[model samples]
Target chain A: MRSEELIGELTAGLRPVRRMASPARQAGLWLGLAALAVGLAVLANGLRHDLQERMLMPQEVGQWLASVLAGVLAAVAAAMLARPDRSWRWVLLPVPALIGWFGSLGWGCLADLARLGPMAGQIGTSWGCLRFILAMGVPLAAVLFWLLRHAGPVRPMPVLLLGGLASAALCSAGLSLFHHLDAAVMVLLWHGGAMLLLVLAGALLGRPLVMRRQA
Target chain B: MSRTEGEWEAWMAAAQAGDAAAYDRLLRAALPLLRAVARRRIVNPAEAEDAVQDALLTIHTLRHSYEPARPIRPWMVAICERRAIDRLRRQGRRGGRETPIDDFGETLAAPGANKGEERVAAAELRAAVAELSEPQRTALRLAKLEDLPLTEASARSGMSVGALKVATHRAMKVLRRRLGVEE
Candidate 1:
């Protein structure tokens, strides 16, 4: 063996690690399944209610919901690619499916917005401008993430960039739904702020494992 | 050859129960890996050899400090680092000022099988780390590399907790960007 390998073997010594008990892990499995069920129920009810309220405008509903769901899916994929947890892989299943579901709904919404005639032209002007900026910024950040090709498991810059991208997408999606008079400022401060919050939540969740990790 | 985990655990139990022969066997088993660590950190072959020896001796002296209930790796690591640091200090004082040998614990495995893949990973990480301003680099080296706590690093580096936090954050950001973690 190489000298370094030999040394590594020696230092490994007779130190056998103590693995965690299996039953405790099983309880966590059940809990996660329960959570996933809850999420599905909430989504189902919300969708049913929204559909009933919006008459039969299929195209507009599909557009608005599809884009939001797609953005979520993109974020989830980005996260999984960044960190793949075997136990968490199950969470990935519904995410993409939900995105597909939402995308279809969102398509209708986008169509509805597009049809809001020249009489309500300012709505188009503002939403269109904001949407364009958001669309450009979000995808640009995602592309930058791909380009960066970060060599490690977790790094600050990539995470921040991912956060920025997610934030832009989230802000745009929120503004698309609720056009407060100051839509731009609302998206920038409130929506952008919430996205940053989510990013911090993700980092916080991953910290213990990442922090203890050897470089 | 791979030993079963049961056999390894049994050996550990025996060593923990004060079986002298089992303890000796354990130390000897780890010799190769310990030497590898020393070789990687120490520049001179002779110094590396001596450093490993001293580290082994410390391991023997502090064998009881290894809690039988816990994994033995960290205990061994702690001893190895302490000895390595002493050697670095002795040598450093001779040359005016010295760098700590505890700057790195283990070299990371590279991802690809390209001939220079491992060397390249090391080079890239080293370059990224080196690119940090002295304070950021120092904080990173202390906290992540040496695995020291923020408070201990603060005492050693004389940077306040807030300043150290900023340095570590910036350093982590640079490393992340370089590695493409955000992407």
Candidate 2:
């Protein structure tokens, strides 16, 4: 159709569209829902028995703080990426936070190397930790995805990555609050592994699942 | 005829509130800019028009997402350029099986070809091609009728090779439709 004809046809039937929430507001809403989801998971699983003692450890405290920071940064990045005109710069905004998160894990691993010698016979792998992170991640991811449905993300892969990371980070932190584990290796392996998997899944599925509808 | 960014934003904001007149004004004001943007990326005038139309439609659907405080030009430009690029990509994927102009002559000369029928068909084809828009006619004449190579035709017509291809393609489409040929 010609531009004029198309414009005429479009404007002829014009109707009011309720304004979409601002990206910041949408991010806030997603964070609020994430907090609620994590709270529910905590209630169902109960806090770790020695939560006070764990909190006293610098390694544990750093890990928790990194997780929270990662979640916040990722959420903000996702919000910016949701807009079609926004540059990929927003995707990089979460990198520092993610580095902090991984740095904490690395620190914990270094500090716990001596302790690992005594527990060499027992692998620190936990099926429950994997299950818990994934379980918590699902609803949080769902909420973030739902919030972004109306957004026209030009770079779907990065947006989805940030969203997935945000959810996974929050879920990992929530799991730490409820599940007691002495091994940082378990947290690094299971929690970090789950986050990586979610990010990969988001990149693979993002365009086909989310972008196709918008396109 | 470029509207200031603030003016465009105001119009868009008002349009989002169901002001049909404001919407119409915004579209009319933006169409030429949209066309220019699309044409820069899309060589074919028809395809450029289509891209502009698509961008306008997208802007309409996503108007509510536009922050009144933000400049409208970049948003519109992004949509226009993206749509135009998408058209180019789609054309590329269709794999240039465009009917060669020589094929028309070959068809007329095939076995059991009737002279009178050929003349009539040729006349009809000529009339249809002549009726096309100037850009399409120029492309067809330079690229097909004159048997000029794309580069030479592009130089003669002062259009890019990509645009000439698009015009030729569109011209062929119109001819096919008018001649009752299956696409």
Candidate 3:
């Protein structure tokens, strides 16, 4: 049929639709879910033994702040990228936050190395931490993916990448709350590794799962 | 149809709220722009219209995603372009054989030819086409006889455009040999 005819037919029976949640609201929802997932993980594995002391320490506090900031920035980026027509500028939103996250992690790692004299023994010891982040990330990624599905991203790769990054960052922050390992090297290696894996997985799966099928 | 950005956003906002009338207006206003976008990509009018239709359907499905505060043109353009590319790809797969029927025009127009001779030539041409393989014959029928563009022919025949082109080329070569016609 002619496009004109089809347009008429399609719009003729149109019903009222509720507006989709704004990007900020969607991000907030994902963050809320992340908190719940983290709580469950903490219940399952217990919080760090020095939780109160670490929470008071500047190094730990800085790492958490940077991770949380990265998560928020990444969530915003994901929301914007979910739209096919979003400005390219939106992709840059997470850059500063990501840099800060890495910087804070590096600083924390340096402090630990100075105080504890090398993390050689702890480097690969916490495979469980990797598993924990992935376990937590799966549900977070799922919720973010659900939100993005409604957004109908045209370029699913980038959108999914951002969503995965945001999910990983949020999951990493949650891990910090539950896992007591002061070894910043472990956090960098395992938690960071999980985040990278999620982004890569998202990139690979975006076209097949996230994009709308060709008409 | 040349609405200001605010007007377009307002219409979209209303549509998002289930204002069917506003949605209708927005779509009507957007049609020409959508058509123009599709036409830029698809040479065939029918195919271009089909792309526009596909994009409009997509827009309808994704209407809620349009933030009322944002400009609507980019969203519409993106959908239109994506649909147009899909139509083009589909058409390319069908392989358009737009060979003109004019080659046989002169023979049919020969002055000395009587009805009996014309019937003989027609039968010979039909027989030649019939002798070709199924794929070749279908390609010839859709691309040459029916004068369908490649994409539409591909859609009808379930063949990739490249395969249809090869089929049509081979069919023509066979016909030329049988008819003793120059390329």
Fraction of the reference Cα-Cα interface contacts (below 8 Å) that each candidate reproduces: 0.00, 0.77, 0.66
The residue-by-residue lDDT of candidate 2 on A111-141, one tens digit each, is 6777665435434668787787777776677
- CAPRI-style class, candidate 1: incorrect
**Tens-digit lDDT track of model 3 for B33-141:** 9999999987777778888888888898788788887779988998788779878887777767553343355555666664777888999998898889999999999
What candidate 1 gets wrong by more than 4 Å, as runs, is A1-19, A22-48, A51-196, A201-215, B1-28, B41-183
Quality class of the docking in candidate 2, CAPRI style: acceptable
User: For candidate 3, what is the DockQ-based docking class?
Assistant: acceptable
Kindly list the per-residue Cα lDDT of model 3 for residues A118-146, writing each as its tens digit. Answer: 77855766777678767777667766876
The TM-score leader among the candidates is 2
For each candidate, what TM-score against the reference?
A: 0.28, 0.72, 0.67
**For model 2 chain B, the run of ten residues with the poorest summed lDDT:** B98-107
* Candidate no. 2 TM-score: 0.72
Which scores better on DockQ, 2 or 3? Answer: 2
Question: Model 3: how far is A88 from its true place, Å?
Answer: 3.0
Model 3 error, position A155 (Å): 3.0
